[model samples]
Target: MNNPIPPRAKKIPHTLEIHNHVRIDDYFWLNDRENPEVIDYLNQENAYYKAMTAHTESFQKDLFAEMKSRIKEDDSSVPYFYNGYYYITRFEAGKDYPIYARKKGSLEAAEELLFDCNEMAKGHSYFQMSGLSVSEDNQWISFGIDTVSRRQYVIQIKNLVTGEILPYKIENTTAGGTWSADGMYLFYCRKDDKTLRADTIYRHEIGTDPSQDVKVYYEKDDTFDVSVYKSKSKKYIMITSESTLTSEYQYVLASEPTAPFTVFQKRTRELEYSVSHYGNHFYIVTNKDGATNFKLMKTEEGKTEKEYWVDVLPHREEVLLEGIDIFKDFLVVSERSEGLNKIRIMRWDGSVDYYLPFTSETYMAYTTTNLDFDTTILRYAYQSLTTPASVIDFDMITQERIVLKEQEVLGGKFDKNNYIEERIWATARDGVQVPISLVYHKNCKKDGTNPLLQYAYGSYGVNIEPYFSTTRLSLLDRGFIYAIAHIRGGEDLGRKWYEDGKMLKKMNTFTDFIDCSRFLIEEKYTSPVHLYAEGGSAGGLLMGAVINMNPELYYGVIAQVPFVDVVTTMLDDTIPLTTGEYDEWGNPNEKEYYDYMLAYSPYDNVKAQNYPNLYISTGLHDSQVQYWEPAKWLAKLRDLKTDTNFLFLDTNMDAGHGGASGRFEALKEVAKEFAFLFDLEKIKS
Candidate 1:
């Protein structure tokens, strides 16, 4: 340990021939998780990382404490009325997890605890719960629990009145369950064990053994995953099967649990739509008929076919129809235009409709829990880079909006007025305008000497909204400019924005991010020597790409659970998310896509060049982007790169894609990241 040890990965060369092209992968042997050599190498990397950052260990703890102090440990969420109960999630002081409880009728009633995650998570290192579905009669509750951090869960029923756990437990589920109206049966989606894909829907009768559960529907397509949920209207149990590009749905009457589900629409390539049950028809948001930005359509209950569909909100060339929350008398639609999200509320009778106005130039407003369909009140949450998240209820009848609660920043020193959030557009090489959302301390100067951390996730149409984060205060207070690059791959601008950033045009996403960085540098926000970059998962792909393309442009980079070895990962259908992402990253089996992906694929494109100081992180049990991708990428970079810049890997042996499950424990990783950046910047404080 005293000899300045660095893990020199043993290369066992493996040749891969695809489309008549021979590629040599020297670190292919690292993918074997069971091999002791692999574990030894990873542990050595961890040891080296710890030794390298030992000087910042004290700083890391202080950063963690500073971040934790900003969060109110005993805070409770705003309760929302649902099914004759007011559901609330609150945390207890000194605890990591929350207590999910509800009141029978009013908030003042005696609290009935549904699940105490602190108690259930005591013995496990990783734990998560989902699908907390209460029965129609409120006598039974079904929930999905995952203890292994692999996204696979077991569905268990509980008797609320007697406070007893039921004997029936459905295993290998997707952590969701839909309870029928009569509470006689529960429907859940089952995952394929090997792929961890939710591919089948099953029905389990109350009081029956799980072994007796019936397989109601099977999604044989490897590229599609299935999910089951009861409609907000509570009249139908809907089952949806979807991939990156297409979606199909089937539904059954909630009162008739044994009845077969009828297909709402047949599946078609590149056609994506979602359904919501309403009075006598199903409201759908679809991208069919070349509606690139998508539009709203409605169909009769029995004649639920594409041909019979009629437009409710006609396709707009500019506005992207994101989603809709249906109510008895009003429909709240979430739409995006010019890279900003807005909410439009329309009355059922088509007499009144108007957009909800926001005061911030860059803010995120989305629908929260609106379980009651008959009410005039609409619940939504809003937040900006400078503003704490606020839970709001809007009255559709009177157009009055009430802020129920604004998140309390535990430390009294935090003031929204002391910060400024703004939006700017950067021009890409192709002349496409890329939007940038940034926030900084009001006292901070727009100087090129300031350190800037830019983040982006441009894949699978997942738009990275400019949301508030309490943990980010550490960086802002330290004079760091935090910016989000709304690059092309995401649906930030419109559906066309995503379409131009994927498949053959995928390079747009990478170059757009680089362009944004250059623009910031030119604008005096930060210079290349003071710039740092970060991204996770697919966004991590952006991090790897930018560093490879312009290594001298960044002072440091942090990639968390990165999907770096794209060409290799996509070539293997055995990977959990590979098959389902064919439409996103494109299938490498095709020669056209193979050449296009390899041109920018991070691992394959690692050449002998200088790279910025890097801190890469991965979870050993990550199912989404296998840990081997980043491990292989790191080994290759360390061997080929000519620079002596710092390169470190931190692997969580007991975690998965989401990292540590505990609230406080996850902050340690963030602290380590901040400490790494701070040390590189010579910021000892």
Candidate 2:
């Protein structure tokens, strides 16, 4: 077969000037989604990708099947008791969607179907149903559906007892609503049509037209987004407006749906906090008074002002207070210390305090599903690099645990003992130690001849836990070593770790990843000729920046829905996440941030140099990162790069940020990615 020629995007130079800096973008014309020429160009690139990899079609199919075979076709999640019923989400054999059901009082009771997503998704190419909220009486349920993949859901209600759907519908919502204590009204957040930001909170009375719903509150700050939810105590409905560095909350009595909401605290610059209700006080986790790692405080129900707050747990510099779960007798706290997750169990009366024991240093553990506040049973989940995920229920009094369910890896070929999982630290250019979690087959060697794939997402304080994956088994069995680099941009080590990697210090994220790659090569775990790197979204930005800095360090790279056109995207506030992310990427309206971002913006930094093999993907309907960012970046690379190495752009026409709404359908995307790596390595089954 002959190699296919890559698509050449027509150049129409468009000049943009901001902060006294000028840039000439030749492919700026591709940003218009409504233009037929833009669609034609995307289709041409799609065809080029198909033609270039046509020989790997069979291998890709087999790879997809191999990965899919490891999954249990008929599986149900562990049912949890909530509001007099046990709710379950189960998948049927050979189906694309899950079936949501419930049983009254006990698991042995007759099941009542809530939503058969397979049936609901029969006619749509893309489908998603989320934010399922059940009324207090259990006679009604509310859900949001999005068929276009843009995440703009339409909310609807259904009568669980009569099996009749409500006539009213709410559009352009954040997909879920909070039901009032009397179940008479629903409170939901509304999104702006253009930017897709949730900026308003509204209340909808049951059996009334949504157009007549009352606007309860509006968030005037463009940098902050709003959301509505019921307190865990079920006594108050909360409206929270939050930015990256600040937050403010309001609340109203759940029993009085028409009552006005009272402000718990006014928004102060750089003051970040969250509220939870228990008995007669509201518990807060906050970063007040320079508590960079956050601290727990409590205030009486009527005295929610900051002046009335008293310390429950004072600030600790080494530990990050992630969150808390409230109960009548006990308090569960989720914390992170020394790049590891810890779950602490403490009684309200201050008689007992302990932490759930975890054996692996590189594992992830967190509390889950303790909705009933009166119970002594505490449910949590645990997973490691080699171990499958397991859900365990613990009795707070007896210190006993029951394993409710463990993820079943089918095909009879999986054994935890066959793999080695460990954590290793690498010194960065600045002498800071970065953690890397690695897993490989026991038979693999550290001879530098082995192929290794390193991945990281160093942004938004998001920590990518070292968890098990059934899909990753294919790589391990194929003699591939997989690694997760716990770099500085994430909150892996604590709040300071994230703060040191953002704003003017953003370059640390890129350099830390490069240092980790070099460390792997220096340790003989993998050579530069066999090293592969992967990251998506902000992590994709890391991929772009590192390759620009040191392209020869990686043999191949996969960037999924990359946010490469940073400066341009940040300057335009009309984009979905631009305005709200000013603190994240920095406000480019300032000359200092503009110069710093342009210095590292991947698309702006493309130049004449030898490049590695690249596989880039995006969705046409992506609301978070526009598809044009990747399209334009690829065009620039094709025009400038001097190498003959392959560069492919794949555009998913039917999906959004998250590709393919189905469970099995999403696997095909992974298969394509794996095939790209295998083909480059000349590995064929």
TM-scores for all candidates? 0.99, 0.99
Look at candidate 1 and give me any clashing residue pairs.
none
Positional deviation of residue 87's Cα in model 1 after best superposition, in angstroms: 0.8
- Assess candidate 2 and give its lDDT: 0.94
Q: In lDDT terms, which candidate is top?
A: 2
Model 1 over residues 585-633: C-alpha lDDT tens digits? Answer: 8899999999999999999999999999999999999989888999999
Report the lDDT tens digits of candidate 2 across residue range 92-172.
999989999999999999999999999999999999999999989887899999998999999999999998999878999
- The window of 10 residues in a row where model 1 has the poorest summed lDDT is 1-10
Stretches of model 2 off by over 4 angstroms after superposition: none
